[model samples]
Target: MTAGGARRGNTRFVVAGLFVAFVLAGFVSGYASSHPDGLEKVAEEKGFLGQADDHAFANWPLADYAVSGIGNERLAGGVAGVIGVSIAFVVGGLLVFGAVRLRSRGPGRASAPTGDRGPDDPGPGGPGGVGTDAAGAGAAPAA
Candidate 1:
């Protein structure tokens, strides 16, 4: 891999590690703010707590960030948190995968071969393509 590629991979790793650390800290410390969180606090201060109606899924599994029917609050909360993280990770991975797949192809075209080419190669912004100097005034300079 090029230095830039390696650097980007390392940066991603660091970010992922930090995310894991933060989630673990939240789970272990149970050190959330004692103050009422945003919506709850606003409702209380504005005397609009009654404005909020019970959600349709109020009794649904995973409601209130706890597993349904779990006897232990702490364990239920932890399991719910882990499930949330897992869902987030899967969704994020699928999004990135789809984006990469889409960008690997031209509009209505098959995926391109992943290859290194000279700077003169005619890509989407190359001399004859859209955003090329010959085609537009604000075209980007060739790399």
Candidate 2:
């Protein structure tokens, strides 16, 4: 496909993905169970739940899967989920951009190291590293 076509397709894909992410984070997350997860359940069953200390960021605004100062539990959770998803998307995009930028700034690389071979060096193809064979007829096209 053409570069423009490929870019348009990628854009569409990203838009669809973001739409789904936002929907799930802002709406579907509200229906998620509030019960303890496996780790918490296991601790509770083992009678060690009370021994667990609060997380370092337990007092953070988005801690406990809910945003602080929100009266509605579902809304608070939804808002937190959306915030988390948005933050993750932005962070991931930044990482990809940084990686691409770094790679572009590095030295250029060729598919094959053509410089190592001396001017007189006959490649694996014998005679001419490229072009015609010894038989006279054009080389049966490189693989």
How high is each candidate's TM-score? 0.56, 0.65
- What are the lDDT figures for the candidates, one per model? 0.64, 0.73
Once fitted onto the true fold, the runs of candidate 2 whose alpha carbons sit more than 4 angstroms away are: 1-6, 105-143
Q: What are the root-mean-square deviations of the candidates from the true structure over C-alphas?
A: 10.5, 14.3
Best by lDDT: 2
- For candidate 1, the per-residue lDDT at 127 reads 51
Report the lDDT tens digits of candidate 1 across residue range 8-81. Answer: 87868866875785477438635555577899989999999889899998888989778888888777776777
Scored by lDDT, model 2 comes in at 0.73
Q: Please list the residue runs of candidate 1 whose C-alpha ends up more than 4 Å from where it truly belongs after superposition.
A: 1-26, 106-143
lDDT of 2 at 25: 91
Task: Residues 7-99, candidate 2: write the lDDT tens digits.
Answer: 787978877998899899999988888799999999999999999999999999999889999999989988998999999988988877664
At residue 119, candidate 2 shows an lDDT of 73
